[model samples]
Target: MTRNVGGIDRAARIVAGAALILLALTGAIGAWGWIGVLLLATGLLSVCPAYLPFGFSTCKAK
Candidate 1:
């Protein structure tokens, strides 16, 4: 799949993901913590399935 994440979008996702995981590990969040894992995955992969259906693309494809 093409990269649909970039710039601050990607950066924010990564940071948020990390924060969520840390918080979850500390028992700050429950099942919702899994959302962070998903974010981490999407950020690392540079692809967001949600963006596809909405025709959203943050990265300018090479």
Candidate 2:
């Protein structure tokens, strides 16, 4: 898959994802917080399936 996620977006996703997971683990959030895995995965992969249909992308043209 082509990368649709860019520098800041990727970083935000990773941070948010990690925060959610930590909150879940600490019982500060519901199990649904596990959904953060999706964010983490997308960030790491640099490909966001959600962006496909609308042709959205955060990457700079290269």
Candidate 3:
């Protein structure tokens, strides 16, 4: 997939994802924290499915 996430968007996602994963691992967020794991995966992949239909792309055009 093309990189639809970039710059601050990418950094924010990474930070959010990492925080979620860390919180989940620490059991500070409970079972709902699994959602954080998913976020982490999507963020690491740099592909947000939700943005597809909306035609949103944080990446710059070539």
User: Judged by TM-score, which candidate is best?
Assistant: 2
Give one clash count per candidate, in the order shown: 0, 0, 0
Candidate 3 lDDT by residue in tens digits, 1-62: 77688677877877887787788789998777667666667678888888898999988777
- Which lDDT values do the candidates have, in the order given? 0.88, 0.93, 0.78
Give candidate 3 regions above 4 Å deviation: none
Instruction: Write down the TM-score of every candidate.
Output: 0.87, 0.95, 0.79
Question: Which rank order by TM-score, best down to worst?
Answer: 2, 1, 3
lDDT of 3: 0.78
The reply for model 2, stretches above 4 Å from the true place, is none
lDDT of 2 by residue, 1-62 (tens): 88999999999999999988988898999898898899999989999999999999999999
lDDT of 2: 0.93
TM-score of 2: 0.95
- lDDT per residue (tens digit) for residues 9-50 in model 1: 888999899889888888888767768888888888999999
Candidate 3 is scored at a TM of 0.79
